[model samples]
Target: MKWAGEPLRPQDAPALVSKGLMLADSAPRGVVYLSVPLDDWPEPADDTAQALLLQRAVDGSPVVTPQTVETLVTALDRASDPALVLGPGADTEQGFQAAIALAERARLPVWVAPSAPRCPFPTRHRCHQGLLPTDAGSLAKILARYDTVVCFGAPVFRYHAPSTEDFFQPGTAVYAVTDDPDEAARAPFGRMFVGDASDALVRVSDAVTASDRPWPAPLTIAEADTSGPHFTAEAILDAVDRGTRDDDTVFSLEWTSAEMFRDRLTITRARSLFYSAAGGLGWGLPAAIGLKLGRPDRPVVCLLGDGSPHYTIAGLWTAARHKVPVTFVVCTNGKYRALEEFAEALDVPKGEYLHIPDLGILDIARGYGLEVHRAETLADLTEYLKKGPDAKGPRLVEILQR
Candidate 1:
């Protein structure tokens, strides 16, 4: 709140803003907020203010101390039956590649933590596994098979449901390598170390001898029959897979239900698959548009559920305005399907919390002035999606599945 001369003056606002920006830049990564008085709102922006706004700087990722790196390398060398969990910190291209290299060298099954903003590992790899579930009990059950769990760039655990079980069973060791010391400090039941994900991965890979254990087999996807009368979620995705073979299109899944079937779709690229690690909706459509704009050569596809797109459906207009060629496949089940499952799991009585029959997303997509297609049968869905990837403008295909 300190000012150059006095507080709350219109002239001092520029200096205050400048100082705030500087402080935000000089950080170990943090959220900084600047407060201005109500009287400051109507102030005029001069050349100095304009110049302040135009300044930009790049912050570099922090490096690990030699001592911490030694400790990590020693710990990894001793670990047998070690499993690696790649977290959100592995979002960068280098970090993702390093993780894969480390996993391959150590013969470890690489699991994507639920905190990841996108898939960090190639799903088609022998060591690659999908995301860890948010339930502590479920996560513990799966991790129980391993003697040691090594976490990178994410917390020891991020749970969505209440569970009495500990993150790991007795005698199972847990270790973490993260860039954030704050995260390392608060972590429960783990030997935490601080390091950049990519660097640490490389160091660990080099220090440890290649494991003699056999690499796990890659997951197999069962081809679904798309000749049925009604549209099933599996069939729709299979069709999308068939249609998108011409070009390597990045698929963004913001819809929660679609996330369940994500393993069905093969992700060969490191960062091509994206979703909200926090499990929030409304990011799919807009994210697809941004991806298209950033990489005009590659096509983008958004797989959104019936309820997910409503939060950011207006993104379609921006796509149309820019003529971004994104294929949006909306899975219309006519209800908040995830919540319905939640209710059933909790043993709650049947209620209307799961049902919403009035709204039509097709009409809404049409209102946004994008090409819309509704599919009642699998054949129809496949036919429309076959042309979806190469479509000139943004295309919306709504699959009516019960």
Candidate 2:
């Protein structure tokens, strides 16, 4: 939360609420709480209160100065190899388009930041270099080739596994553009520009000289083999990608095989993919329902791990009751694969509780009023997803991964 306030009197209620709304709608938007006493709710409003309630908050993003734009343009033009790294903040409509324009104009390879909640650039673009690794050593090795690195709306780095290596190699110049002051301050080494990233991207794109350098190699994914009796995570993700190849399809993902999903699926449109930045489980089911509610014209496909359904099983009931047309794909390996992987990464013994051999996910979904299907092969999964556009209500497809 960025702000919190309490109203002591009836007259203060309107002002506090108005201020809270403004702060919540501002840059780096977040939650704001305004508490009011129960007695103040029924009080009569004065002219001042009425005026405050009628006020509207306009866009307050700071304008990028000419000198700041020149500094960035010079940095990009002087460097032999420059790259752009984006985070969830660049997922907005304006920011998405601006980032693409800047990357194309400056001939910079674009990489999504680690733990990104949204896709900032077109996944199929020629200049895209895929996602950055979450570990410091691997991430540093990838960025070491670039002479200049400009990060937009992302921190200098975010790590997952423990590492003793430095985040950047020596002689690598770094710059950042973000709306959050705290993110700018927390950066280990970088010249920070605190403002709307979209504004800065636009200004820099206009002033920067077009580079004559060759574009990086396009990303490629090997085809998944499906000759086996049981489906693999790669096969399931490939089926989902092929089933929803339309531009209007949106994906909500919280499955364990996130790296596989990133490699297998092609997301060419901005805001087409959503994930939980904080690594929260059970976000897939509810997020799919809400995304469908907001974007009624787009088809929403939710991918979840088998163990994640237990965390928010009631979301199926809500979807069924509301007749939301979201296709829930639960990849069932009959265990919490993420937990086991984490334990292995930490070089610890696996816990006895890691195995979930008795969970009946399909039965629970059907009990909650959803139509359920058990898919044992890629053909079965593909057939089910083909009917997603005409689905009248919520449906769950369980893909058995043995």
Candidate 3:
């Protein structure tokens, strides 16, 4: 499906797609781009939403497609490969466990595509690549090689500037499965399977499995790239990965810096995830606050950028006034570095649009009565973060970057 606008919960697109696809028993072959919320569990549905659900589900299935166990049952039967590309989308820790249960039943290696980029669950799923940091070429390879690329809950035509070093393969079959009709209508890459991603995924897997066809060989786990300088982006993520605890919640605002973090970070068993998929700056800090408000017990950290801060500096005051104890780590790059990377990928010089520094966020955080900390290296950054909750805080840490 085609997804635009601020952002939708990672679950909504997939939930919509998976249901739609199962409604089509022939099964669709394409990519799915699931969009998830930056915060935990979906925001509670409003009364208007309740009315919408009731109106749609007068008898269910034709519309309300019961968020059922049966959908997954079908996926186990249909899967052509012994692995599942489980991504973000779908509410309910209960629903997640259900999907995992089915993955185990089929002995499928499950990897998360990370509806949001700040996830290392790729490694957890035993996937060698972190969100498959390949360019259009590499993605096309994955897309073409699969006899049936059943993407549950994602959009078509993913556009990334430095997405991968590889090139796009044309004419490869692509499919998008999403719950939202607008998402389905917008999909450009492949035919869409509209409905709940979780359910459609389950149904397709079950259908493929029941077919008893020879499943594709499991994708080989990529060996560690121990090449020179170890300059790969994942290396940076690896450097900071050890600092996170399983229980800690992660909120990142810098999308470019995300490669290092997502490629390297380790997700614990009980973890919460958030990020601005809309690529909007400044949402990071507010998102951290939102995540905290949604799950106040966990340590929530917002990894930020200079360009993005201006969009939401007021978030500091709100966090302070509300007494939400979120940790803010500003990766002190000068400006919109992610945009710069995009320009380079397009073979253009840095845009005139970039090249502006901001009033140091540190002073502003302190002005708002937050505990401000500064770190120039990983060691220092880790130490400041370890200081734990401050009675007078929402702590802010500025980590000087090259």
Q: Please write out the lDDT profile of model 1 over residues 203-274, one tens digit for every residue.
A: 666776677888866656677656555566777777777666643678888767656567666666556777
lDDT (C-alpha) at residue 138 in model 1: 87
Q: Which candidate comes out best when scored by TM-score?
A: 2
The TM-scores of all predictions, comma-separated, are 0.84, 0.93, 0.68
Residue-wise C-alpha lDDT for candidate 2, range 250-323, written one tens digit per residue: 88989865553574777877788898877878888899999999999999999888888778989999999999
Candidate 1, residue 179: the lDDT equals 76
Point to the candidate with the largest lDDT: 2
Q: Worst ten-residue run, lDDT, model 1?
A: 1-10
Q: What's each prediction's clash count?
A: 0, 0, 69
Q: How close is candidate 2 to the true structure, as a TM-score?
A: 0.93
lDDT assessment of candidate 2: 0.84
TM-score of 1: 0.84
Q: State residue 379's C-alpha deviation in candidate 1, in Å.
A: 5.0
C-alpha root-mean-square deviation, each candidate? 4.3, 2.1, 9.9
After aligning candidate 3 to the native by TM-score, how far in Å is the CA of 218 from where it should be?
A: 10
Misplaced by over 4 Å in model 1 are 1-60, 222-227, 376-383, 386-389
Q: How far is candidate 2 from the true structure (C-alpha RMSD, Å)?
A: 2.1
Off by over 4 Å in 3: 1-83, 107-123, 127-129, 133-135, 162-176, 189-191, 201-240, 269-271, 351-353, 389-392
